[model samples]
Target: MRKISVQNLKGGTGKSTTVVNLGAALALKGKRVLLIDTDSQAHVGMHLGIKHSVTLFDLMTIDLSIEEAIINARENLDCIVSDKKVAVLETMLVQMPRREEILRLRARRLKNLKYDYVLVDCSPSISLMHQNALLFADYLLIPVSMDVLSLAGASSIMDSSRMLLQMYEMPLQIMGVLPTIYDGRLNMSKEVVSILETNYKKLTSVLTPIRTDVKLKEAAAAHQTIFEYDPKSRGAEDYMRLADELLELETRLDRQKQKPAEATLTA
Candidate 1:
């Protein structure tokens, strides 16, 4: 499965929104998607209108199986929900051995599960839970709101990911930097987009920005994804495009990986 963690060090950058909508978009495209919510706020479940007694906390602290913790949130989409109880895991993880690898190790159970994508919704803070999410993911998807502080927070996430790579030698790649809540009428938004494209385009992909839409907030408030709430809305369209971009990028990367082996055989 393609494992991705949607993360940002700043709140209100649309991390949970991106995770829920993007996952829903992919699921609508006939892909089996699993969303893991690591945030204490538990926005993913709330967005999907799924309430569960068992959560990520149960999976880590107790002997809850992955299957038992997973709840079917929508057609072709399943979720491992989280709640305020997850906040205690930050302190609890400190005394655990290989705390950074806890999520990764537990996620190994998913190898036999047939999922096309596993998307993790991360909290907006630097903690053991954040490290676990980073270590467990194969790719990091950053959502940056149209603001200077959000841009800086995205940079900090990249720096921390680099540090983790050096420390653990894990092959975590940048899926893309997504600009969220973009408004073309606002000069600040335009400037932020320009800066993002100029600085990050060459380093990593600067995906098509998600346009500002009130429908997105309404969807969340209504306990549904953008696709479910307003399929024709700009928010829904943006997320659909994001799903397509991610699939194309993964396919290209797979082909690039195969080329080396193909050349080896040819030689």
Candidate 2:
């Protein structure tokens, strides 16, 4: 029962794309998954072919549990949707205290659900909505494009992320920086990758670049996932590899927990 947020301070870093495909990929591995779209654009629900006008506004500001807002995308894929109207939550809940805890409260019910993962898509801008996303997250997965603005954006976001965690006293771990839409053949791309590794030494292999594949845009336009559109495509392969890395991390965490319990028994 872990919550993961995919966020970036700047736009066009493929944060939403990584979160969406990763959810689908994990489900393909038989993990029952939920994707919470905290973005105002609300493209995630559309990607799953859902036209329901009901959105996160209904769940966040009004009366609705996480389960009540969840829409079934497939046998294993579920989504808690949002829409442009979600931007109204700030004004809607401005008078209330603990407004940022909206996501945390809703997600608490998921503790008992038989879910393997909950992947959250955070809005690009820094808003209370993004705060909700962070408050509920166990870890943050930041997607940084190999571009000047996107790289610098990570530092700005680290400041904001730190502030939010400090407010809540959260001990959130950075899953890693995910580099997307990169073309290694270009000198700029290679140079940026080198700078990224040098600047962000904590980045895991999960930080490897995902090539700028045409299939990604095409699939997004069609409201389909890379796996559904072209499983053999480089973009699809990259996402699958990312998913595998996440699975390995989950396994490692489980072992880390068991080790303390084993040590206690030996003592």
The TM-score obtained by model 1 is 0.94
Top of the candidates by TM-score: 1
What TM-score would each prediction reach against the true structure? 0.94, 0.91
Residue by residue across 1-267, what tens digits does model 2's lDDT show? 667898888898998788778888988988898888988888788676675556778877776666778788877988888888888887876777898888788668788777888889988888888888888887788888878898887767767877777777654456777888899888888887787788665433346678899998888888888899899999999988888888878765565446633311110
**Candidate 2 residue spans exceeding 4 A from truth:** 203-206, 252-267
lDDT by residue for model 1 over 239-262, one digit each (tens)? 999999998898755764566333
What global local distance difference test value does model 2 have?
Answer: 0.79
Worst 10 residues of 1 by lDDT: 258-267
What residue runs in model 1 are displaced by over 4 Å at the alpha carbon? 255-267
Pairs with steric clashes in candidate 1: none
